[model samples]
Structures are given as C-alpha cells and as structure tokens.
Target: MPSEPAIASAPHLNIVPASVTPLPDAKPRRALKVCLLGYRSAPYGGGQGIYLKYLSKALVEAGHQVDVISGQPYPHLDPRVNLIKMPGMNLFETGLTSIRPHHLTSLTNIYEWMGKLTGAFSEPYCFGRRVLKYLKKHGRHYDIIHDNQCLSYGMLDIQKQGFPLVTTIHHPITSDLKIALSAAKSWTERLLIRRWHSFLIMQRKVARELHHVVTVSERSRMDIADAFDIQPAGISVVLNGIDTYEFRPLPNVIKNPNRVMAAVSSDQPLKGMRYLLEAVAAVVPKYPDLELLLVGTPKEDGESGKLIRELGLAKHIRAVSGISTEDLVRYYNEASVVVVPSIYEGFGLPAGEAMACGTALISTDGGALPEVVGDAAIQVPIRNSKAIAEVLETLLASPAWRDELAAAGRKRIEELFCWTRAAQQMTDYYWQVIQRENG
Candidate 1:
C-alpha cells in the first residue's frame, strides 16, 4: 500500500454570526464554505439520509456554499449544493456476485467484501479510508467539515490534519445492539448480531477522541455519553427539524374513519412492529373493519409476518414501499390516527412528521419521543400492546378527542420544529467550531 498523504492545515476565513443574523444590529456573517460527509445516504435508507438532504438544502438557503461527500446511494440534494459521489461495493444492493477480479486491487474493496461475507458491516470503515484520501488532497477548500454519524478512524485523521470537524451522533448503536440481543432466539443469532455491530468499536473510539460531538436530542446526548464513556457536558444538543411544508395536511384527501397508519423502515427488532401488530389484533375484536396502512414493507417470513399470521391480522394490514413524497403525505392525511411504536428512537421522525401532517399521534415514551411530541400526542409505555390497544380504542371512539389532538399536534410542530430553524442553529454551531479551531 502507498503511504498516507500529508494533512492539510486550516484555511483562514472570517468567522462571524450565522447568515440569518437574528439580531438587527448584528454584523453580516460571511458565507461559509461547508463540506458535509455521509457514508451511506440514501433518502429511504434511514434518518441519516433525511438529515443530510434537508440540512444541506437549509444551509444553502441560509447563504452558504455546501457540498455533500457521500458513499453509496448518494443523497438527493438541492440544485445549489454539489454532491461528490464516493461509491463503494454497495453489497446490500448488489449481491456478493458483484465482486470481480479488478476489485481485489483496492484494499478498501477487499476489506468491505470480507466483512460482508462474515456478516459484519464494513461500510463506515471503508468509507473512512476513501474519505480520508479525498479530503487529504482537497481539504483546504472548506472552512469546516461536518460528518453525519460515520464515526470511523479516518475522521480522527481528518481532525488531526488541522481541519475543524464536527460530528452528529444521532444515537449510540449500543442501544440497537442491546435491543437485538434481548430479542434474539438463540446463541447463534446473538453472535451474528454482535458480529454485524463490530464496527461500534471503531465508532466508540473515534467519538471519544473528537472535539465537537453533537446529538439530536438531550436523551441521545446522555445515551451517547454513556455508550461511548464520554462526559455528558462535552456533548452538545441540537434537535432535528421537520419539513413542515412538505408534510402538512391536505384537507381534500378524504379520511378513512376505520384506518390507522404507521411508517416502519424495516422489520428490525428495535422498530417494535410486532407490538403494533399485537395492538392491532387486540383492537380488531371490537372494530371488525379496522385496517392498518403501513408505509414500508416487511419481509413475508420475518417476525412481523409470522406474528400477523398467528394473530389473524393478515386481512387488516396493507404495506406499501417506495412511494413518492406526495403519496406519503396523502396517506398521512387520509389516516384517522398515526402511531409510532418504536421500542427506541434517538429522535422520532415519524412522530414529528405525523404531527406536522396535522394527524393525531400515539407514541411510546421511548428515548426522546416525549421530548418531540410533548403534550400533543398520547404517550404509552414501551413494549405494552395492551396500553396501545386501549389508547387506540378511546381515540377511535371519540372523533372530538381525535380532532383536538390533531390540532394540538400541528400547533406544537409549527411552534418548535422546522428545517429552517435547524439550519440556523447548525450554522451558529459551525461558526463556533471554526472560531475555536482558529484560536
């Protein structure tokens, strides 16, 4: 292998207040040159992709030059921001058969292939190696670099190169590992789960060494500190924002009085889909016509599928995936109630989106959920199907109560969360990091 490239020193730039310039008398903040990094940012992949998409657009709107450097399934960004594609093996999309003789020449490719073969996730680590190589050659172009939860060792290298780096740790992957282990059926399953999460070792080390670590919520700040053994005070909090304009209610969409809706990304153990299915089954005894419209698909042989068969909920559930944003908003508008049954969430995007769509919500008081929903939605205990069922019954029976909750939810989201506000807060933090690095 060739030698590592020399680290570039920080560039000189005037750091001042953010573009919004909240104060009338405040001086004009210079348009910052920003570089955002994401290891795998597909819009439908997860929250990280959504975060990258909206944040970059918002920052550009705030009068800054933003570039997104991502690997595999690059993000959908605004026209103004540049997208620097850094493709990887993408073994998830293209099976192991995609590897060829030419792939063996690159050590990063070999590492990624081997890790995937062994049931380990190697995207973050391989992405780090690629990113380090890219930035080492052109690191001086940006005033600051913000990473979206790809806590790889290469990030530490980037920081060592004298660049001002900030990382957003949405939540600790340790939380997911714990939930998966508890739900495992056998020792072999437990072992496989641990192997898949082996990259956490790199993440924990990098997180501890980084100077500026931020999280989306106070719960995540505390959890990340505990999971990585860092001090809570050292971690900063910046709540995520909802795209209120895109997710708002459409009055023309006719509501289905007997239907409820949820958006689950996958049939993962941590998503708590089984609990929601159980709740739906329990409620079916009362309302025979009750139906659930799930926005994401679940594997036919997965736990959720098996539970649906055992509980006789096959007829009551319908799932649709890969739908456009317009279709998603329309579904949200047509449902009588939206439920977020996550066992845990760093920041509950579904809950916020549901509320923003002017729909009544029922969510478990899992990590940071209450912080997002506040008094607007009905809060239930985690892993309790009976509680969820009782709440559903009460809400479905009372149209007046449902209308009241819906109004409150929309008001709360309008007052507290939005992409514009998130971008402004992030811009201020960027200036803070740059000034500290220069000093």
Candidate 2:
C-alpha cells in the first residue's frame, strides 16, 4: 500500500466523516483487488449470508477479483471468487462447559472462551483480532477491505496500519438491543440479553473511527448514525440489490389461495411473527382453510412456540427450516401473499425476494420496508394484528388487487434492485474511496 498522507494535528486519530461529494464521472473501472470481510457468514444464515453471496458474485461478474475473508460458518461464494477462511472458536456450536485447557492456551482463544462463558458475544471481537493478524501479514494482497458489520477493536488497528477500509453497518446493533430489552419478560432475561450484545460497545467506537462506511438503506444510515453516535453525513446508503435472475417468478407454479408465506430467520421478537400469527388466527374463522407458511424455525421452547399453542394455530401454521434455495423461490411464487411483519429492518430482504418472485407483498411500515418496496406492496402499521387481518382478508378476496401488487412489485424490483446495478454503484464507491485516500 502507498504511504498514508501525512497527518498534521492529532494525526494518530483518523476520523473520516461521511461526505456526499459526487464523483466526477463514470470512468472505466480499474480491475481492483477487493476483500469482503465477515465475522460469521453462514450460508444458511439469514440476510447477511445472502448479501455476501450475491454481492460478491455480482462484483466478480463485473470483473473484480473479490476475496471473502470470513470466520466460522463461512460464506458460500461463487466459484470465481476466492474464500480465505479465518477460523474461530465457533463457540456457538461448542457448549461453554466443553472448553478444554488446550483451548485456552492461546490468549486470544482464552479471551473468546471467557467472553462466551460470561454471556458476552465476543465472536466479532475475536474475529477482528484474527483479521488484523491476517492483514498484517498479507497487507499488500488487497487494495481495499469492505467489512460486513464486524466492527471490532482489530478493525481499528487494521485501519490505523494504513489499509483502506470500508465497513457496512447494516443497522446499528443498538436497535436490536433496545428491542430485545423491551421484550424481555424477566430481570435475568434482560441482563442476559444485555450481556449477549456487549460487543455493540466495541462496534459503536469502531464505527465512529472508521472511514468509508456503507449501509444498505437510507433508514439504516440514519438509524446507525443516531445509535452509534456517528454522523449520518459520513455514512453512505447503498440499497441492497435483489438477484433478479435467481429469485424470479416461477411461471409454472400455481399460487395457493389460502396460503401466506413469511421468510424469516429465528422467531426473534423483532421479526414480529407473533403479530402475524395473531392475524392468521383472526383470519382462520373467515377463511377456514387459511394457512401461514413460515420459512424459518421457531425456538421450540421460546415465546413463539408458547404463542402458537395459545392461539391454537399449530395446525394452521407450518414452520419449516433448511429449505433449499429452489424451494424458497417456489414457495414465494406459490404463496397468496408474502408478509414481512418485522418491527424494523435495516434492509427488508424478504420483501425484495417476494417482489422478485412476483408475489404480492403485505409488509409493515417498519424501518426501510417502505423505502425498499416503494409503494409496490401493501403497507400496514407496526405490531397491528387487526390491520394485518383486515388487509390480508381484503387481498385474499380481491385477486385483481393481488395481481396488481404482484406485477408492480416485480417491476419495482427489476428497476431498482438488480445485482448488476448495485455492483456498479459499489464499484464506483470503491474508486471514490481509493482516489480520495490517495490524494
């Protein structure tokens, strides 16, 4: 890497502000060396993995040599793109009691083990230490490192070492912490929730220190600014793109009249699955055959399970996990409507996916859903089961309205959410960062 520009006053502290100075023009893109970094990017994992998979593929398609450096549950990348594995304790898989003496021999491992034992989710921090080690040895390998929300202490060191770094803060983890705390039933549960998200402290500090931050939605950028105490001006909002080709409608598939699909991860309270279930229960009396197909697992002993039984919706609602990508698309195509009842989303992938599949969508006016869907889908208020029930009933009765929403949703996705377009925009952002830093 070229020698960093000289610093005058407080030189050691490099604080890059979010600026929106437009780049000069569309110059021919230099075939840049790029590294997409993630702490834990599991393929079957929710939106983060999907973002990595498609974004890297699109960047590779645009002729950039993209390398994904990830910790445990590595990302599934295109054959053309490189995967550099950075291993961690993956303590989520290993129980805390199973820690052996040999594991604690390494100081980093010891720190990670202890953090997990104390209920502090330390993967991001531990992974950052590993990333810093890797980059120190191979600093010349990549022109730029684009991080996927692993804002840890090591990331700050890497930036200080003069590597051009850009981090995408999907949304501030503070929002998650706030929502979780609010949902906790007991004092012990709230304490545990706080401990599990302790890494947000590190992330908050790192986010403010770093330069060239990218976010998936304008709403996320704004929310991240408030949550992390970073300037919104310093953060760039790059809307997440949909894989139009892979997620397109299956014309041969017949839509189910009484079925509604929701693609979510764990039955997290933030997902607002409880509201959807209540809505489903309310609808079942009118449309006796009404069924809710959830494409994610509920914690068998968690609130979701208890609620399902309470609502007597065990038979009416089916929760399935580990479906293949093909099956996901097929479900999207066949469902009467896809509902994303998230209380908030940094970027609503479910809405975009359903739109790409030409499925009519009913989503809450959660963070970024309206921005992503853009009047293409029906919008309901947050945490309103009655509103959900009414809109759903209306959509079920009006096939013509559903058809209008489906067509509009598909067209909206096509125009605004193409992977190629996102890559091009990101590619331009990369050049701007490099050129800005060089000068």
Candidate 3:
C-alpha cells in the first residue's frame, strides 16, 4: 500500500508581446548546411577552383558548415569543409585525340567517349549525371546548394527535391568559344571549336531556369544575361575577393631586373597569353635581358608552345606550373611588374592578386580588368601586342610611374578586394535568398 503523493497544480503561463527593436550588435545567422558544386575545380591554377576553396573557407569561418561537390581536378578546400568528389571520365587525361574502348564504362562515360570522338565536349553533361546521382543520396544533408558555374541538367533534379539552389556563373563560356573561333585558322577548326562548346546550350538553359544566380562582377552579370538570354533582374553580382595574407609582398625578395609576370590557365582563350608573348618578342631587342615569367604550365604540343618556339622565346620566356601559393606570391614580389594580357575576364582575379601583392599592374581593357584595376593600373587595348609592348617599355623605363601604380594598386585592394568584405557581402546575399524562400 504505497501512499500517493498529492498532485501539484499545473502552472499557467501567459504570452505577451514586447517592443520589437533591432539589436545593434546582433550577429546574423548563416546557413547551417551548405553545398557548393563545380564541374572542374583544380585549385592549383583554375579560377573556379580557387573560388570554391576561398568561398568555402570564408563560409566555414562564418560559422557555417560547407561542402564542395566537384568533378575532376577536385577542389582544394579548407580542412574544415567537407569535399564530395564526383569524378567523371576526364577525357583530357587520355592525352590522345582518339578515345579508346577502355574509356567507356558507364552510359555517361560512353556518351562522353562518343561525344569527344566526334569533337563535341561532353564533360558538362556527363558530370551532370554524376552530380545527380550524388545529390540523390546526399541532398538531404544540405540547407542550400550553391553551384559554381556548373549549370547542368542535374541541378534541376536537386532543385525539384525541395532544396534551395543558388548558382554563381563567373562568366559565360560563350565568350571563350567566340574568342577561340575567331582565332581559328580554318573552317574545320572553327567547326571543332563550336562543337566543343556545345555544352553552352545546356548551361544557358540551366542559368535561365535557376532562381538565385550569382556572378563575380557587374560586367560578368550583363554578359551572362546576354549570352544566356536571361533577365538582368534575376542575377546578383558578388565581386571576387583576394587573400591579402597569402598575396602580400615579400620583404626579403628582390625584384628581377627584366622579369615581367603573367598568370593564366590552359583552356581559356581570353587569357591572351599569345599576345603577351608577341609583346615580349617586340621588347626583347630594346631590352636584351628582358624575360617573361608565366605562372602556368604550357599545353603540350599545343598552339601556345608552337608560337613560343616559333618566336624563339624559349630562353627569354619561362613558364612554371604547380607551385605553392606562397612561392607564387614570391614571384609576384620579385617581378618588375605583373601584366594581365587578357582579351576578356569575368572578374580578373590575377589582376586583383597582383595588385594585392603591391605589384605594378599593366592590364588590357578586357571584360572587367578596367573595372578591377581602376586608375591604379595602366590600361591597354585587348589583343593588341603593340600596346602591350609600349606599356611594358614605358613602365620599365619609368620607376616613378611604376612605384606610383604599385602603391595605388595596393591601396585599391585594401579598400575594395579584401576577403573579409567579400565574405560579409556573400553572407548577406545567402540570408536574402533564404528569407525570400521562407517568405
């Protein structure tokens, strides 16, 4: 016979409204789970890869969990962020013009093999299938997915799965195709270039359909809108940021007497390395000791290499690849000036990085180089070798102008291109999308 304890009466609570006021120092909330997607993200050289790495690092630093889902040439991300590797056939690895039977395993792989065999690049579409498969299994883990310019059909499936999707198109690939086609010597070469860039059709479609779109620059936003036939209102411009800590001038390094530095990747025609080489040739007679230091590997047996040999610049031009960021920054510090001979750029990260390191900049008026460099850099016309030569010679001859531009470049970067500012702007944009979706 256990004695029952007397039951206490339940307490009643009343809800009341309080005066609503914004807290002056309250921190903004960020996404708890974020996924960034890319087709190819190699941090060693490519801009997209570098974007994925820094953006993920910045997001993670801002108290958000970020994951990068990428294809071949996997991203180099901060250890805090998870990496989801979605590998493709990577036909570029084959090193041969023809695809062998071993390359065809999955249906997607088969399609890619056939496509490449016929001169049509299928990396985007095949990568889409792989991404779709990955997201089907892992999409539930993310609060939002941010695509890094890999606009593909697979994204549609992820969007349909009730997840918020945002895309960052650094620039349009159509620009690359147009530039390459314009440089093609024969109709067959032009046809091949067009076929290879056929993936633009899919990209255009995906970009138009996606609700939240981010691009690196205002110029890029307009170009993408025009290229993809999308409304400018649907796109948001978030300028890219440079890491000043990694890109700062090295005090111990002495500038090279005749060394001029330029950074570029292998695939893009808009980089304008060819024009830079021609400019180097033009200046070699006046400055016998002059040399060009390219911060990228030359494509093997490619047109670029042939041009370099044809111009007899093998001794004067040095192309180094696969170096650490610290070492690359050292090159920037040791150079007389950093040149950006791009026909077009979405945001011109190289220009920003060079300027960040307190290097004198000489850039062509490519897509957004002028916008990035402002009056801090000497601007030249795109694809004009003579202009590049004249600018280089002028800068080399005038120590006063070089020093002034160098100081201005660094100041501009400090004011406009710091990573902290970029991260804050991106965080705000992320919240805006989330609030709009919830509303």
Report the number of clashing residue pairs per model: 0, 2, 0
Candidate 3 lDDT over residue span 157-225, tens digit each: 767776778888999999998899988889988888888888888888888888889887777877988
Candidate 1 vs candidate 3, lDDT winner: 1
| Backbone clashes in model 1, listed as residue pairs | none
- The digit string of per-residue lDDT tens for model 1 on 275-370 reads 899999999999999999998887788888888889998899999987777788899989999999998999988899898898889999998888
What do the candidate models score in CA lDDT, each in turn? 0.86, 0.84, 0.80
Q: lDDT of model 3 at residue 375?
A: 84
Candidate 3 has an lDDT of 0.80
Give the TM-scores of the predictions, in the order they appear.
Answer: 0.93, 0.93, 0.90
Model 2's lDDT to the true fold?
0.84
How far out, in Å, is residue 1 in model 3? 91
